[model samples]
Target: MGGTLRVNSLAIQDRRGWQKPYELTGRLVGIIGPIDRGKSSMVDCIDFVLGRSVRFKGAVDDQLVAVKAGMQIGDEEVFLHRSRRRLGVVRVEDLAGDEIATVPINASGDQQELSDWLLARLGLDDAFASVRLPHDRRLSFASDLLPYLHVRQEDIDRFVIRPQTSADDAARLAVAKLLLELINPASERLGARIHDLNNEIRNKQRKADQVRDFLNASPETNSGTLDADLDRLRDDETQAAQRLKSLRDRARAATQFAEQRQQQVDRARQRLATAEDGVDWALRRHREKATALAQIDASLAELGEVAAASSEDRERLALLYDACPACETDLSSRAVPTGRCSLCTETLPGAAQHKEKQQLQRARERLVPEVAELEQNVTRARHAADLAREQLALARRAVDEDTADAVTPYVDAITAAATELEALRSEITTLERLKEPHRRLSERQEEINRLSEELDQAREQQVRVGAELNEPDDVLQRLNNLFGRVVSEFRLPWATGRARLDRDTLLPMVDDQDFDQRGGGSRTAVSVAYSLTLMMYALEDPTRFQLPQMLILDSPQKNLGRNDHDQDLATRIYRWIIDYFEVRREALGGRYETFQLVIVDNNIPTAVRSGFDTLIQFKDPHGFIRDLDHPHGEPAGYEQLALDDELDHDGL
Candidate 1:
């Protein structure tokens, strides 16, 4: 709501070559193309450049390599590029083509660098949503909103945000709540705090339980006997310490050598303890490095497997010649060309395969250096750990030799007193060790209480903040009104005036049935209506909603039949979108310049073609990539002429 994200242009580069730049800056645009003409691929470039993981179809995946988009985010203009040659990175550049930043793409995480940059520009950098639980939340990402903003053809006949699990559904709903202003930032922050408190309290409780179980299992010590045992050991230690002082005085007069040896033994024991700690620390570091190396190796293996599988699939598709495997179309009239695809009649050049191999090589090159570095670290850590263990052994031997030398000189004289004193001191040390568990248990319980109180306070504050926000009834009512209007205009058989929005699921409901329970055509109508309603509601009060003023619907007429009634319904749907655009354009006057809509379908009715500001149509044998025939890498400009003619026909 703070600003808008507009795609000004997009350029796609495949194995063949770069396509003509698509001018996408318009209030409304329609991408019309027959099947396999790369209509969806063109739209997917926008999504992929904007930070979405899109897996292109069989041939498209094999041929496509890179995508770049020029975007205007409010007052800022930037160019974004994503390439198959570079793994897990996106290149951001300024208008002058100077590098702005290289953002890393985390394979699995809500806090992505590119998503953060995009969300920050839209004033939603701090947005969050609850996932499995109310307190368990994750940051809202661009991918989370892409499903609603760009409705794919495959998803148009399902719910607006088709979730795979209950947790996914909850997360999507939480995002909706944030956009609708039903959940405020204060509440979200408090929820995070509460979640942290919960984890801390549980950890403390677990430690306390372990300590309690230890005390209970011990035969000589327990929580009830710790204080008594400590007091008894203290009395015995005092007596033994006095006797040892007397014995030391007598032994000092006999010889100073024994006293010096005893001091050496004490120093050696301290060194031994220090060496033991060093060994532990070095070994822990070694284990950590080894684990990291293992993870990197696993990643490299997975990347290799995926690349091999994709290449194999491409090869298999290339070898199919009996018939058009995809559509089973007869190829009897087509001559068997030496180096061309039977389906699309496009040239199959060896340079394209070489380019794919180069991409894989580049991706591997990026990770190989890191793997080598990790291997070196692991080897160095292991060597350090071994050296530390050797030092520990030397320290242990020194302690034993010094102890034996110190005791042999005055063995008979002080044996009875020294032995008795040693026994008392060892018992005291053992009792002290047993008493520490009680102290730790008490501390852990106290921490648990403190965290519990903080958790309660955090929950209370969250509740108070949530109560202050307005109910979403008004928003739901408005959505239902818009949805009903769209459904009626589409003339759905079950389009009763009583169509309402589900309070829990936020889905359209007719005759007490949810959108998912309806037929394919009805489901498509409901899904489209839901998206349009949300966009319209955001446009009405942009300040209250966080939704961007853009919508891209892919093949809204996908499942609709070819009958006259279905044809009229599809036409009416287009008309409704046109009318809504015109009304909003007049209402906002200048502010509506940011609003953009893109519809991708196989065909568009001639009557509504004039309503769009831009039209892109692709004929057979030509698609988003048009340089498939050039073995010497010459640009094919025929597709550009076709696009220009289509635009001229639309009077744009």
Candidate 2:
């Protein structure tokens, strides 16, 4: 089966997994399926052919897997491409439609020449890296460049570039622009030379002025005096510089010492604070314990009094029991001494019974004193906790006093106006320590001219620092450099460089400008524009991206919402992509060769659909895909889940 060029068509061989091998046709293709229906998987399949793992949810577990795809560009048909394996074995048909050349997925080790070849052919060799997404973290690639995404969110602001971003991100953007600019040999070579020559001119002029001024001002200008004076002054400057450096080092050390000491005191104070709270809690517990002890003691005291009185009472009662155990006076006292009348004399059982009762009473009486002692102990614990709290407070106070001494000066300085002399002192100290001390320029006219002339020379000297910014290196060599710098700077993928290119050499960016109501959509459009622009430039070189010679993006509108202000952003994305494609299309030739695009979406501006060669709509899948020719015609063993229902947490 040959590939489909200029159009995307699907031919599925199996439906084993969501990623089951299926043929896709089109340059700009959109696989319209609900999220998780394997839209990204198609992209992964493309990756697999390039010797990359098929990614799933930002994870790559199937590195061993391969993707199978077929393509037809114009009259040429290509087939049997596998991921990573035998990738370059299948070549792209050349411009003539009859010629063939092998293509590499990526270049390695001194493979710069080969990469350049591919990039040059694809129009991408010298393009910036691009932004590719599965979902979430639109801010991720921005991190590589700005350190802050927007101008307003930084730790400090020069027109804040939003927070969580930095100048590093701006550098990435610079790399992107520089990449595309360098693709035009004239632009690249001339830009670099202009930079160098400009520096050179300035330096020569400065040197010329210096020699003229010296000749005019000096009397006799004794060669020896000039030489000696210059040498001595240099030495003096060097020594002063060294002293300044030493003082700075000492100051830093002092600051560090104070900080460490303060930190220690702060930590101690925190501990004391916690201890004080604990002391309060302990005191409360102690109070409760003391109250309980007091109650117990009172009960014990009552028991003691009861026991003391009970002893006397018991003796009397004992006699009463013996004299008349029933207190009945033996029903009438012993004088009436009839054995029957004498209290129906049951003798109150034997002495042994009385002994048992007496022992029980004695045990109860003894508990009072011991209980009182325990209560006293609880009272003592309450007092001890109170004392501990006071001591902890005192310790905290002492730490505060000590820390206050070290920090007070800085605190006062900070609280006062920023114009304190200390601020100037700090600047002076820093400069002195860094001492490249041609810093002091004398104020007289002679000095001003001299310093200004010297400034030109210093700038010229600085030119030896790095590679000329713009040079016509081999196309892919330049691309790699551009992509590497862009990627490293923004921490984004090299492929995403396509998003940052421009047709008119103008740069697009977001800064302190007022935005429309559609924040999400506008941001998304900007992101898409940047990504798409870079790709368009890449496609200009046949040596870069491969055939089918075009790329398509779906739902660049994914995160946009149509607020009053943001309504135009979505429309802008469509118009921009269309305009970009249109421009590149004419440059390539009226009949764009080996390009296919299939965009699928339910909710996007109508303008996007109308601009495409074909706009397609298909009924929703309804449920899991089923094989038309199969037993029972059901989902086989797999079950369709209620996607929106509450999920089971067991495995999770």
Candidate 3:
């Protein structure tokens, strides 16, 4: 058995915003509240943070944005966070706030990333990663053990595990085997050895099946003729290969000559295309130059007319007045204008006019040289265009001549040889296809032999493990002895007379009836009794059980509320857990805390409530999400209507 899991606190927060963590503490924690006061939700929060497979129910409401929890598992602490909107995502963090890992919460079977990670971090042995059951079935710890740790309210009437499918039933059995192993090291070793042997046997069986399928898919073979047939096929393949090699050698020289001629033709074609492009580009440049020359000539003509008009205007202005154009006044004889023309604002200069005319004449002279250069450029461009066109034509002629002489004959010859080569390739393909069945027949026979040998070895090992498995049932007997005492004390009434734990189901059988068929009160009593027995057995000998040493029983009183006897039984169940811890602590002299038990329910007897180490009461406005106020009045449990059982089915 493992040491007790003393959960110091469970701190939950909304990941979307900064809310104070809803922290609950103590070894014997009791979530006490009225019906629907979020007691069940609190239990869910604890289970979720500790890696329970079922989704937290009552805690996840529409107002809840996200759910995150920080908890101490034994001595190590970890933080878990999940979004309400995205149920499948979860993030885990260390105490220092470093992200440890994030995983999809609902990963498929055999893809248990988050579960496996948590299992490793919880310090569980890797050997427990997978467990084998009878009929060659295997179960993952995530799907089996975690569910059993926290039994649901609806599942109280069911067995230790409420399996929803056949696969789940097998997983439950595997979990039973695992629990048994914890109490018996001999059983664990034998089980592990047997599992490994079974795995090897399965592998061998698979190979044998594959070999049989391969042989069945192909033509039947005679062992005596196989070698002879292979040799004949190999010889034919070799002869065909040799003929192919000879043909290739003979064609090599001509093929190389053809390739060289083709390369020459390709180069010629490229050069011709380049020259043609050059010719077009030069022609375009020549046309542009000619247009530029025409524009220059027109610009010069416009400049000459503008100059003549300007000279006439200067002469007329000089005759008009040496006057300012601002005001009309006669000042023809004045050196400087005193009166100005009323129509225009100007101070006319006689010497400056002649300087402007001289500047125009200089500009005209510059245009004449530019126009001549453009004409010369146009002529040069035309000549380049003509040379490029001639070069392109000459190149085309050379390519045509090469094609007519060297390339044509070789291309015809190569094409004929290629056709013949393709025919030989087809023939080779047919022969290989014909040889395939024989090849498969030989390989399958070899595989069958190998598998047969391995299967024999696996069977021998399995038998050895079986012998080891049969050594003794001392540990099981010890467990049952404890279980028997607990059930007898609980006093679950059966229709027949006697009640005992079924060795196969690991559940209580009353009067040869299954646990699920019993009355609600009896069922609840047996369930609690079963849990207490497991704790008592492990606490008696910590080395014998690998349970986490913590049990979370949610709303056990729901199904046991009908009569005083049943209620008394529920009270006893709670008192038993608290008393067991107290006695163990006293005996150990405060040296160790060996077990922790949590009971979550709407109703807790006053005595039971007072005796607990910790109590969290949800009343009035205070509930699961402490800060957020509920809008639809008081958050009430579904007391008015019958609630369906949440039978969570983990499937393949």
Candidate 4:
């Protein structure tokens, strides 16, 4: 089907500091600038225009580059302006200009008139609406976008390849698979072949019965070794599959145990950090109180001494003497200015002494009262200090940072649970993966015993005979080659990625195989490894995909695989992702219609960037109304955002 996407135009509406609108044209898409020039974040603006249910996962402190997407559909040049809302609004161009009609996704209507009319004319499905705008947000959120549209990554696989894996599998599906299987082999006269086989078997049985009657008197023939051989063959195939199954089950259990344990450890760490913070807060409060109390005591002591010195003497001294409180001297006399203890002297100028005596009495009154108050305040300060010290000690003593509790039990429980789940998943993965060998074993077992007995009887009867079994073509070699090509220079511990061809089954089984046979730990580890790898594998091939092509990876490179093959595989695994994209584009005419890869850039392959259609360096710079040319400097190149006042309205 022919497809087209573009942003027709934009208008500048600068409001917030750096935010302005730019008219974006989708057809003229290309990388904008050098790495540091903010070429990576340009897509965020497209996302903003798409209604932010698909906003960037986390927070960004600054404004981001913003642009509104104006999409023009095919032939009629159908115009639709979508600006980040539920279902975009549609418009029809008439002589009057673009006229707003119904919603794009049709919230109120049963079907969108705009979409319906467009698809009907184009001979496409209703799904075409999903691809209309192709906002950067949609590009980044392939995973989340599934529910909004019927377009699925694994549709071909589920419907055409492995229908049985899904609930949709049924007798009808089996019929379809059978038809496809026959078609793949270029089978002719399959209908006639079934009829012929049934008739021939009947005839053979009838002829053998007639011959036995005629030779009844010859001898009673009983082949003893034949039966035993047949039994042995049956038992062997079942046993191998069963052994593999058992080993895989144990492995799955181990994986679950590890996951649960890790979760427990995380919780415990959070709890420990919280408890420690609480203790620190209390400690700080105690220290603050204790220091304040000490300061209070020092202030009290100083005030107490001044008050106790001599309130009566200070008042008397002010009148005449003005002597120092400690010295208790007189400065009333002009000649010497003082006498030792002037107030206490027997011989004196009696009337003059009266004035100095009065001053001393006033000083004593003020000093005595203040000293008593100072003594009370000191007592209070001492008590507060003691209490603060006691509280501080209790807080220090209670903080048993090391002895409180261990995350061991929680981790162990989590580990055990995770281990169990892991084992189950491993067993499941292994059983599912081993389809080819299991099928072969079943067919071989059925024939082995019968043939052995035939050989034995022939040795006794002097005849050699054999049975025939249809040998299904071995696609293992082809599968491995496909995986290797996809993996290219990958690095990860990988047991195997396989594809088996079977008339009874649909789609090739991928992921950890023979896990049960592999030890418990190995099986469990392989299950996890294989599941992830299979997911990666599917994503690599867009045509066979069931999920989004975009990848949201965290720190997955840490301790990926331990064994020789696994470790070696881990080294090149990430690079394989790049290769997968490259191959997809090469195989098809192009790359994913819309795909995104968000990750913590570590150990990233040097060549991976080429696969990325756009690199969003997530440092969020500016947002806009999508008017590219206005007053501000041109950001990401769309002519400068021009002001409305700058437009030549007079020409109109």
TM-score of every model versus the real structure = 0.59, 0.33, 0.54, 0.27
- Global lDDT of each model? 0.73, 0.41, 0.59, 0.37
User: Which candidate achieves the best lDDT against the true structure?
Assistant: 1
Model 2 clash number: 73
**Where is model 4 more than 4 Å wrong at Cα?**
1-67, 70-81, 84-102, 110-492, 499-509, 512-574, 577-604, 610-614, 619-652
The sequence of per-residue lDDT tens digits that candidate 4 reaches over residues 336-423 is: 2222234444333323444544444454455555555555555555555555555545444443332234333355545655565566
TM-score of candidate 2 relative to the true fold: 0.33
Please give the range of 10 consecutive residues that has the lowest summed lDDT in model 3: 333-342
lDDT of 2 by residue, 1-652 (tens): 1111332332222234324334354333444555433344444444333233333432122222333344443354443244334544333443343435554545456543323442343343343233221232221211322121111111211211222133444444434444433333334334444455566656655765575456436533433444455566556556655655555454445455455455555666665566566556655655654554454444445434444544334322233232455453422112211111224443332222343344334444554455565556556655655665666566656656655655555554443433333454555454443332122212233455565566556555444322333333443354444433332233221124332222232233333222221254444444434344344434555333222234444455455455743446555545655665667676875334344544433344655655565433333452113332322234548777654434444433
Quick one: how many clashes does candidate 1 have? 0
Model 1 weakest 10-residue run by lDDT: 351-360
RMSD of each: 39.4, 30.9, 18.9, 38.0
Residue runs of model 1 more than 4 Å from their true location after superposition: 107-112, 128-142, 198-445, 467-470, 627-652
Q: Is candidate 1 or candidate 4 better by TM-score?
A: 1
Off by over 4 Å in 3: 1-6, 14-22, 50-60, 85-89, 96-112, 132-142, 182-450, 460-472, 494-497, 589-594, 627-652
